[model samples]
Target: MVPQPFPRHIVDVAPSVGSTIWRYSDSFGLADPEAAEARLGLGEGGTPLMPGMGDLLLKVEFVNPTLSFKDRGAAVVVAHAIEQGAERLVCDSSGNAGTAVAAYSARAGVPCTVYVPAATSNAKTLQAEAHGAYVVRVDGDRAAAADAAEEAVGRGEGFYASHVWESSFLAGTKTFAFEVWEQLGRRAPERLVLPVGNGTLVLGAWLGFEELRLAGLVDEVPPITAVQAVGCAPIVAHATGRHFDPAPTIADGIAIAAPPRVAEIADAVADSAGEFMTVDDVEIADARRRLAEVGWYVEPTGAVAVAAAGQLGDRGGTTVVPLCGAGLKWPGP
Candidate 1:
């Protein structure tokens, strides 16, 4: 019973957009056809292997359907949209998520509207547009665009496909941890490092392992090591006894100044042996370059885990890191 789980079906779309295209039908394809696809590698699971990043294994979840782990959740989101008989869908993504939702909506023959910050990366915005989604470029910051999208949806515009507060997306996203288990031969890691934004990767993976444990498929989830950009770490501020701080980091992906799921994110870290850390733009850039040199192209946000790894103490066991997004999604500086 994780908090606020989106219906298994609406994992991808935010409720602010339109009718959901997903359903709460089954577990990570435990005995279902879609689950089989998850195994058989039809661009489903099995992201990529970046061996020996540390004692922790690196699962390149960024390689999913839309070139990011977001695709997994987006699949659930769009599927539910169909079930709800939505005529169109709406979403506000800083980058990857909008592209993911738009692409999946196209696959399902559903129209999608994406609201993006005017400063959104060109590559990501282009990707969403290429997917046949109507791109709404709002003036002001990312949150402003999100607010506008919500308002539009509230006015009977379309499904919101809001990712921040949606719980189902986490359920869909949890599948990544299960894939990590299968990739690691069914053994849970001692620690999992993830780059946090709205708590998607952290929360999603947390729930996935819990579900597996409930089904007796695994024993326990490892303590998670969640990292964020120094400029935009709201939870880190909270963790360090700060009531609130204004974050403004260039690791734009995880530079979330305010997360609606703050309480939940903090609870997950505290409950597990997890700790949250932050890295600077220089560190984020360095990590990005290093990962790319290894042929693992990751965005600045995706590389925060790698940057944090440098500061982490010995946990004395395996740790798993989610290499979240593709570098290509970011346009040239």
Candidate 2:
């Protein structure tokens, strides 16, 4: 027997609820209109855009409800899951996505189970559990946890609220672009520097900008540069024509050995005329220190993009880098 098709993750149109996505609802793919309306309100979006060293403007996403940019996606995904009659929500995350799912699921009154890689920070795992989620630590890598979550979903145990696979989550993340556009005086930036694990943020930003350009709201979409840890830089390797063997990096959030959305990410990079880059752990740690010294305390993962900004060097335009997670999420100096 042929297997049934899963629900379409993203749609062309979403509901207008006066949030960051309302104006662009006609451009996004949303799973449930009711769930979109029922989305949790924990001050997820509207993060501040602050001036950083040089021309790099920092989109401070660490102030989000879950202390990470993942909340932007999780709010929409969990609400959609509940509207679709899901009794339980399941996902695999390095840390931030799991915490986001757990928090949103709790808000929606649904049980949540998050599978996290063994190397996930204790602070993040504890945050997820604090939201009343059942946390399972997978042995191997982030991909291993993703495999387990997929297996559970295939067994009909729960709805897979995957941050990577769920189109709505990407829609939620697209708000970053919209916010940036508005913050930048209704214009698109010249470049966007972001960290890529599953490539959710990069993809979402591309979609959002594409919609805006199509709507004649923006003249152009900014080139979106992605920063990956040197240890696990598949997209970088693919783009640069270099062989990659996964190593260890402090940017655990983007330590994805095999990203499920590599093709899509590569497409976004090409479409935006952007580039992929890699930063070693030492560089990440140094960047983290610099950011902290400047009073912007972000995790090592969030510092990857900031570290990469040095490579751009006097690009004559507004460059934006999203500080994706809080520094306190990890335990270190």
Candidate 3:
């Protein structure tokens, strides 16, 4: 079956009176009656947008039910799978996305299988296992796990709920932009700093804000800074015409050496008058520690945007950063 198209029009419907992303269901372009009935949310989205270090504002995405922002997309993906009469769900991740798909699949009463890189964090793997998902540890990088999951789908093991390839996932993540706009008094922020691995959030934000702009809710899409790990920064390298050899880093979440949507990711950033930046493992650790001291304990990957924030030249605008995952996801220093 063909993938659902990304939503464009924002209907003039009243927001639902809750914190769940289903509150914006009408905007996601799901069918009217089914939109109300097919809401499978565990209170994802509606995270706090609070002031952070200096002039930065932190969007605390780790407050999600799964302790990461992946909940937002996973919830919708599972619902779509159920709508398609899927008997089982399959996905691949380094950690957070698999855990999210597992949790949401559990909620939808669907069996799930998650494939993860062998080096995935124990905390994340345990979470998926606790959700009763059969976990397979692939012996290569993130892409190998993805290949395993796709092979499972090809063998009819389950529907592919890929966070990287699924358009429905982007539809769900667009709620991040919606919430950000609402939190800032129905206006887009001057800029958005986000961690990029597969560019799910970056593309989602682009789609969301563009819809808002088309609906006349905002003047234009905000500039986006896509942050990546210095050790594995294909997007940055692509943008700057630099060659980078893949290496291991503490920021495993953004350690994708070859993201499937690399070109689209670069276009989104450039379209928004934005740029790419990379931070090393040392910088990530320092940023994580600083966030901990400020009572926002985010994982090293989650701290990537924060680390890049300091390197940004004084653009003199309201900059927002997203802390994408919880510190507990990776307890090691």
Candidate 4:
């Protein structure tokens, strides 16, 4: 008998209401996030791993529920909390993650309060407000916002839906790897290229592939290649033998001066046989422009992967990249 096709994990879920997938191990009360997503027409993980520059398979995650890849995590995390009888949700997000949490929380009839830094772009802050999030314009920088949120969470003001530290979100995000493996006909990818702000995607994909391997689904975890903007690349510096300097960068989405999950990010990088690289702000801008020409409107940070993928020298065939966020999330043109 021939081997069954991969991605068949949901073959019987019908993807509609009253549908159920196999034992996909719903984490964070999102046991059915994928199913609920398919029915709601949120356009979840079914993103095209389409061909792109250098014939790479690019997963357009920007096409998610809130126009950024964070929807995967937000959807699962928020919905799970709703299922758990949670009332209010609090989060600290610069742009993408905040917007995602707001939208998903609204879907679940939960009040979402987001704390964004003073430097957060008007576009993102407005989007958060548009999604009915209690957008609190905090003072200081992104790191400061996290601290403020932490303090508030510690005070039991609300349930802190930390995008970085949420294990449920990490599990939901990892589905990207399973989808990628299936899209490639169950063949392991040559590489997984992406951008690292909070290192959410990298960690998710790594965990997902590990689960798949344990389930006898895949043979190995694909190599991860995460790229960061030179302006703020603490993880890259930590991984590439460079000095750690938490400077600001134009890629505000990935301008994580200090990520709460630093050690996990570093370990995930090494375990996946991955290497983190940094690119200049100018190069990021150029990728954004070029992607726009392809009708790929992504934020500067989202394009960092394209910049890094191009530099990888084409040895790894069938590269998988994700456009982590949409351009509309950026400030005014």
Candidate 5:
């Protein structure tokens, strides 16, 4: 069967809002009558939009059910899997995505297996295992884990629930923009600063705002600043035509040396009149600590956007940054 195109139009339904993405299920176009009958969720989305350093607002995504924004996408992906009668799910991640998918898969009563780089933090791996997912540690980097997971799918082990490649995941993530628009009084922010690895959230936010724009809700999409670790900033390197050698960093979540959607990510940034920036481990550590002092305990990767916001200073209007993951996912010394 040919895959249905991702739904875009808002369906005619009662306009009642709730705290979860399902509140706007009609707007997201994922809650068809049949899918809604067997929908799966863990109360993802509708996270707080609170104050941050200087004039920046923090979209507290770490408060998500899996303690990361990945829950938004994972919830939708798993629901799609179930809707398609998938018996098992397979995916790969450095940390947060694996844990999210595992948790959601468990919630859906489907077996799951996650592949991760051997160097992934124990806390993240343990989280996935705690959800009863079979965890496989690949010996090399993030890409190696992805390759192994793909091979498993190739061998008919399970449906590939790739957070990186799944459009349904983006459908769920688009709620970030919707929630932000609602929280900001149905208006779009002047700018969005987000950490990028596989560009899931960045692209999702763009897609959401574009939908709003097309629906005559927002004036225009906000400019997006995509942040990356200096150790593994392929996107920034691509933009600047500079050579980079991938290295380990405290912000492991954004340490993607070769994101499959690198070109799409670049185009999203450029189309929004945005720029890319890199922060080293030292800066990430500092930002994480600073946020902790203010009661936001996020992982180093989560602090990446905050770190870039500090470096960028006050440009103008409202700038929102996302604290993407819980610090406990990788408690550093």
Candidate 6:
């Protein structure tokens, strides 16, 4: 098969420029979705929004195909890569993104290589491998794994499908806001709380809401409350003028010592009248247990949203917190 030429840069193609590729693609605005070669049989979006503890509405993202919100972005990134005729997809992830890319690439019949930190959860790495991805364990931290992936991609070994750097991926994640608005009677919620690692979900939701407002779909965007693990919160530290050295945390998903988009996250939160809150492992564990009692059963990282919601102290309007990953990926309590 002849290789399709890759785009020189990723552009936010207007919705008018493309047909509806998925129910949410109308909101995503990626150009030429029908031309994308990758098509995963597994349904990617439409996670349920249900009632949660203390006036919190839960966006149950853990029910996705790979049991994490990462599937949303991976679906788009993999599709775009296939459209570009990539021989293989490559990415570096702590866990969820790797599993997501693995699953989507498998469905697309594309080869995949995922570089993951050695400390990544065993269950997550196993899941990636189960999806037929070649899992390469890198020594050191998440950033180190990312660097290795970049270097390999730089060598033209495979096309890079970075969750953090890819604009198309955010197009998929942006559906979160659209779904929330639709779920809440086509109205914007009062507030949104979610865990932040590389700030993909938070940033994507911001983009989603911004697009809605621009399109005159919603009058106002909700205040987005971004949650971070106390152990590793560059965004929070920058926002509050606090200093922190990265430490171990149960919320591995948001344990990003130096997020690539920290400034963007801080600026977006500030612009939206939202604030950043940090929760320790104990708080995350407690939140996880509470969610389990309520029958949610999410990973500690997913529980970070709930844990931070408790710290917000009565925002009053309807608040949505995303429960992003499944508890089955970690050891049972």
The candidate with the higher lDDT, 1 or 2, is 2
* lDDT of model 6, residue 10: 78
Per-residue alpha-carbon lDDT of model 1 for 1-333, expressed as tens digits? 868966665356555321111222366333343542232222445565568555556788776767788877777666655556678899988888888888877877788999988888888888999989999999987888889899999999887776776565675687787777777778788888888888888888888787778889877767888887767778888777754445566677776667888889888887676888878889988888877887788877888898888678785777777788888877754
Which residue pairs overlap in candidate 5's backbone?
Answer: none
TM-score of 2: 0.91
What is the TM-score (0 to 1) of candidate 3? 0.92
lDDT of 4 at 167: 86
Q: Who is ahead in lDDT, 1 or 3? A: 3
Lowest lDDT block of 10, candidate 5 = 29-38
Span of ten consecutive residues with least summed lDDT in model 3: 30-39
Write model 5 residue lDDT over 99-213, tens digit each, in one string: 9999988887889999999999999999999999999999999999999999999999999999999988898899999999999999999999999999999999999998999
Error of 4 at 184 (Å): 0.6
Report the C-alpha displacement of residue 54, candidate 4, in angstroms: 2.5
Report per-prediction Cα RMSD to one decimal: 11.1, 11.5, 9.6, 7.5, 9.8, 10.5
> Residue 324 CA error for candidate 1 (Å)?
1.0
lDDT of model 5, residue 22: 80
Better of 3 and 4 by lDDT: 3
Q: lDDT tens digits, residues 1-333, model 2?
A: 999998878677766345444444444455544445555556578788999577789999998888999988887787677767889999999999999999988877789999998888899999999999999999988999999999988988799999989998998899999999999999999999999989989998998898889989998778989889988999888777897777888998998888889999998998999988888988898898889888998889989999999777897989999999998899776
**TM-scores of the candidates in the order shown:** 0.86, 0.91, 0.92, 0.88, 0.92, 0.91
User: How many residue pairs clash (N, CA or C atoms closer than 3 angstroms) in each of the candidate models, in the order given?
Assistant: 29, 1, 0, 1, 0, 0
Segments in model 2 whose C-alpha atoms lie over 4 Å from true places: 1-39
Worst 10 residues of 1 by lDDT: 16-25
